[model samples]
Target: MTDNSVVYDDNIMITMRGVSDSVGLPYTVNPLELVDREALVELREGPAGSAGPDGDPAWPWQWRGDVADFSALRALNLTTADARAAWRVATENKIYYWTGLEFIAFDQAFGRTGKPGPANVLSGTAVTGVSGSAASARITGTSPGQNLELTLPRGVSGDVGDPGGPGRIQDAADVLIDDDHSLAQDYILAWDATRGKFVPAPSPRRGGPWAIAKNQFSGGTNLNEPKVLAAITIPGQPTRWRPQVTGQVRVNAANGNGYGTRCDVEVRIGGPTGELVGYGFGYDIQNWDWVLIGPRFDFPPTPTTDFGVVQPNQTITLYVIAKRVKGSASFTVDTTGAQLIVYAEPIR
Candidate 1:
């Protein structure tokens, strides 16, 4: 017995590269989800009928390891019967193809330049009854196992918020105070629930308006040289202004004051000259001595009522003026332990 089949070299090297059709494919590709896919020619080369010198009237028509291109195959002018009752068709990027009798659509995938991907079933979460500019999104589930990150829009609880006054609050502008109120330095924001806004307001009284200036007054009197503690401008006109000062005041009679040094401390209003104030006294019938004027004499001598209020809308400053009723006395205002407080009638 002789092996006679060595004459035909039918070793066709066909490589399937790129992405395979993923739709309708029992594997992964679904025929329904295909794009840029070349029409697949599922035919395998074999003897169609009687053999000729080139080889059997078969496809790929490789004779002696020499492959025939489409042109060479077309040259053969094979009839339907010659090719096993049918001829297969394929396309790279054509919308239509010629059937035996007429033109018909190729696989829809062939028309696409890029591979078609599965349609995404994107869904966004709409949280009902929540109002804010803050939004977040994440892919819950997608066909073809896709991962997508999305962001959703928010803001809008109701016409009155939880109370039904909510509106489209998309940014900081919607929550902060209105343009009508001007913010001041060291001021804080007060939440106005009614308007859904943060209104600029004064600093907390618990924190004190500010620490009083630690100033020292000496020699005869400080009537000409005064210490300005704080300056505050009224929020609006016709507002009643009240100034206050609280602190530990120390008085000392240096050398030569000789047992009869008396000092009067004056808390004045206005920068250097407005009137809304108070007073205290520091004295000793003896020479140089340290005196905490608060308990020694009537310190903060004037009652809060006597602390007077003047015109508004202007700069009202607290001025400390000290003078000696008799000899020479020196005074130190302890800023570390002192505070200045001012109040206005028309509250903002």
Candidate 2:
């Protein structure tokens, strides 16, 4: 009919004569199917007052005038019985209303009689809001035309919302990828099949876990062959890596009196060696003693240029090679001098 939107038939309710979009010649209307919820709600909010036969709870009665008391009202000399029946509110919050020359009883609740709050001061003083340079803010207005302005400093912030309970997100993936697989940072967060969660993974674009070799290397291999100075195991086989190596190589003389003339070092990923890093040959390698490959780690040693692609299950290794010149040709490397800290930034 004209009342309700057409919906599926729950059952054949009490039918009436009406044409529907579905039915052609035959007219049928269900009482439940034609229920007008909006019309019902409108009827519920229709004009209501205490004067009506239906006694509405809240009645908007206007206080036409006010008098001091019932004694003062009697002193008005209304002159006739009908004139005495007019409505008048007293200072004691009592009402004087009448119907058909019959006086009505008093009810304090019919009008506002108490303070607005637990301790609200009922004053007619107007308030104004103005911005200030104070460190903290104070409100002048809460709602528009409320005459109160929420005065705040220049950088202060304010938000108006109903107070509610806190909400939460359980998964980090919800924040990073908004619960979508397309936006997941595969290199930074890897899927751990065992735990079934995203775990921090090694990526060539970010810093990986440190692979340190703190064990002392006593009387390292001869300067002729590359000595395995420090070896570190880098987990997660990232595609590419730029390893940062920190440590010093001491080329010890074979006879304790003989030192190497020069020293060199390189990094090897898996099995293959990458580029070699070297410092200039100083006096320690030739006349006086064994060569020290680097300055103290406090000073920046040669940065590793090795961007080797790591294979699966392969560990990153650091190798050192030293060249001999004057004193003794057989100078060996001693790694016990400094602590080696190595880490590889992967590019997966």
Candidate 3:
């Protein structure tokens, strides 16, 4: 027996021998596969409406097929008969086209007919049952049978209020009289009748009279004796003032016993109860011959610190204290030509 088998070549092209494939092997050939069979059938059948069996009109292609331009549209046989048929089946204000599968209808009224219209103007004269100028119109009455008016209402004036109470006025006799002699010399206090107060009288220059106090002491003195040489009483209560003090003492060797001696002098500001507020002392005054021992000292040495704020009614005293530090012989402090002075002035 022979090997009855069919062989397919790598690049074989099988052509159909007839419309039906039912014959012996050498008389017919069958293809293994067909590429684009549907497209091939459509192309072979031609477009719809071209013709049918026995030359009758096929289904009329109502819509133009995927028209590219006016030339393609004009190519369709759009006779009166075809146009009338298309108009009956087509939608108004809409166009149709085929997208390979089905027809897609685009509504021409989508944006045009669906949009809103322009606003209307309001007419004042058209308003019913109301009356006013056409330029400024309002509703007539709020309810039935009521008429509206246009006049503005005026408000009535109120009565005058009662008179206010009288005020107090001062005269020259009503002012107090002050006869204080201590009132500074070049200054005077005058009464202001209108303001009911005492104001200082105006002067050509500033400041009042100067207040000065001084004391001097001259007498014989002994050794090792503390004596209050000069004293002054400050009048004001807790005032700032300046005090100056000077002490002069002559030392003599008794019986020609030439010996050395030291003398001390102290200046102090004391309160009413003798409490020392401020004090300064100077010592070591040597004497071999008859010598004068004295020095002037200022309390609070600098002008910046010169003002000594004293207690109420204080007394400032300058005292002399002497001692024979080295010699066994005694010495006498003679004040025959010696003097102790204390002076004070108010800072103001």
Candidate 4:
């Protein structure tokens, strides 16, 4: 068999054929396809005017080009005579070759009218394909590969919000430290569990002179004990010393002897250089003639003679030393003590 290829509408087709040599044996030959010159030219021009067989006009005697108006075409009064006349004149004199019978039928099937079909009438067909029928399904039984799966194009995914700027940890730490204070307003130092050292707490809520009203005291017990509950460093202006005293130390005698025991309160004000700024001693003991007896609170008989003062460069410390002695038939001595209530500004 010989393979022959031909062009059909706007494409090519291949067919097998067998030819015999002089020996009458069949041999295969591949022949080049030939173009139908007449058909090609006629199809290019589309339908032509035709005359009727009986010398009358054909039903659609005059054919229009692609741009002709369809509505106007229907109004044309073409008849059989027009078609016959056109066919006889053209065929006999060979003025133009005739389109095959099938081609003629194709042109007049709608009787001198044409209209736009579908936008996709040529859908699924590849132009310039092997055959006029268009590139059809694979005929050689070639298997199709796996189906292609489409996905979002690169960088075309969902919108992602921009990342927030990193937090400023160092700045935040500085802010926290700024708000913290070294010691309490009236508290000099406090126990810190984490650092295992005395941490300065903020100043106490109270301030100024902290007083003590003594009520009772045993022989040598509890008198020398300080009533100054707390001392704190002042913030902002840091030049003055501040200490606070609280609670009371009662001075009542424990023994009921001839005369109760006597105790005196003294305040000493000085500086680290031993410069005395003020001094005060209150005579709380009685019986000064024989060896003071009885429990008493003597203010030096006058404020001018007993008041304690603190100079700008001095600090104050107070001591309350109480001693009692008996010179009668029995020998007895009692000692009790009390501390002073010292008030001052904060010293940093």
Candidate 5:
């Protein structure tokens, strides 16, 4: 009898062939079972020794092979489709795949169902209780089979809105500041947020306060105060001033001897005695005529508060002096005790 109890490739029935014909044995058949004594011996002791690897040392079934041709032994397909499907399901359920393969969550394969629907279905996350420029947050959930959403809150601020278009310049006065008749042409102004006020126009370049008058001969605008050129007083240095004119200085009689004489000042910054640094000049009024003032010589020590990071002790002093040609009259040339105010402000 052929070994009918053995499991072979499911398609190959080991006993389908006549055992007697195949094994050169006389086959005997009974109603209950077919038996061939010689064939049974052959099956038990053939080149393919036994049914299982554990039972037989020379078993043909002891080794594994490509299952593609196993159809001859089995009726069912043995594809790993089920395992792959389970992995995808695990990715969808976020039970295993998310914790394992992070890329799976971002990929369309994991969450994509072959369907025509909205990409995402989350409602607006409204921030209910917000006070100032501090803290604010909201929560929202998406629709079924929708992509994840990430929302963040912004903190409070001291100001509001997109900050409307810059303020309009009403007139020439808004554009000008501390302007004397002597032409100070170029100037700029802007709104100061910290100080909550409008700052006067700044100089286009490093120089005197930019001023200009239409007519120089007639002297139309009578500028009362002395226009400050540049002033730096390092405590240890000499304070000097220079007159605008180099040669003979004269006061127009309309300036009333010295009353109408206005002296221009040139300030030279340097070390004490006569070490040159930087220089600037502006008109200082005597009576009213524009008279030359000094690009002076003066040296003053650097103060701790003024120059940051720059070592104050290492810095040399600034020297300042006032030099002006004598007036046709005594007082016209005299600027001994003239008042000067220099205001320096920073622009961001």
Candidate 6:
């Protein structure tokens, strides 16, 4: 046999021996040189066909005569093909495959079934039945095989859950006073240390009573001659108390032809011991107009002396006096407007 040369009539008979033995029959060689030795070698060594082990096509296959049904597949001698392999067929815009027994959708077989189908997808805004960003889908059916329907809820509220713990509350003793219990009128509420609770008690007095006395004096007097203006008597009391005295005397001397004239006023308070205790004095320049004199004295409690702290049955006497100083010009004290007042308030 030559390279790229056809096999002669004699060699054809030799090649038919293997085929005839395999089919269990006698074989006759064709008279014409139908196949060359090179072509035969290429057929054995070349790439496989579509249905061959290498899966390369022997020739381009179409939609099997452009038909889609099983009858078309049967007409193309592919219905009883190998069950392990599949064949691609096109129908309109979709691609399908023959899986020996039946034609399976290409997308479904390869799991490339595009987007969710219209049956599996939903549309429009979300209502009560469906809820999602897209309001895509919701399943509703009482029983299997029934048509799915949108079922909205009645907007009913769920049952309440169990209550929580007691928190700050401990027991009935924690409550202090309520509407059922209240304090009486004219009474004050005070905390009772012994009972550890609030109780009603009598109201306390705010302040004690006050005693007042006032007097005044008038007329003219010579130099160095002291004239008594007014005198106030303080009655005795059961309890010890303090006396606060305020006195004022207006004095004026007739315009003296000699230098300037001056007048003086003095105040004194006497206790039961017959001795003058508190003494205060004031001076005024003698003028035609009346001028004020005398100091206001406040005496608080002094335990050591009866003058500041008046004892029971003690008499308090307040006196006001006036005198002329420089010239012999007659000095006069205003009696009506001038005053000497005292207040005797009880001690604590």
Give me the candidate number with maximum lDDT: 6
- Candidate 1 residue-wise lDDT, 184-275, digit = tens: 66566778788877777665442224444343322232332344433434343333344445443444445444365565556665554545
Whole-model lDDT values for every prediction: 0.45, 0.47, 0.41, 0.33, 0.33, 0.49
Q: Order the candidates by lDDT, highest first.
A: 6, 2, 1, 3, 4, 5
Best by TM-score: 2
TM-score of 1: 0.30
Q: Name the better of 2 and 6 by TM-score.
A: 2
With candidate 6 superimposed using the best TM-score fit, by how many Å does residue 321's alpha carbon deviate from the native?
1.6
| Model 4 lDDT per residue over 249-303, tens place | 3233333333534432222233222222222222233322122212122233232
Give all TM-scores, in the order shown: 0.30, 0.34, 0.29, 0.19, 0.18, 0.32
Off by over 4 Å in 2: 1-161, 169-218, 221-224, 237-240, 255-260, 275-306, 309-315, 320-328, 346-348
Candidate 2 TM-score, true structure as reference:
0.34
Assess candidate 4 and give its TM-score to the true structure.
0.19
Model with the higher TM-score, candidate 4 or 5: 4
Clashes of each: 18, 8, 0, 51, 64, 3
- Give one digit per residue, the lDDT tens place, for model 2 in 96-198: 7644344565766455566554443332333334446544333343333233233444543578879867664334543333335333244456566776765
Give the winner by TM-score: 3 or 5: 3
List the lowest-lDDT window of 10 residues for candidate 2. Answer: 38-47
Candidate 5 local lDDT, 225-252, one digit each (tens): 3232223442211112121212112222
- After the best TM-score superposition of candidate 6, give how far the Cα of residue 130 lies from its true spot, in angstroms: 79
Model 6, position 166, has a per-residue lDDT of 75
Where does model 5 exceed 4 Å of error? 1-231, 234-266, 270-318, 322-348
Cα lDDT of model 3 by residue, 152-245, tens digit = 3333556888886764322234444345312343444566677676644433332222221223433343444444544444444233445444
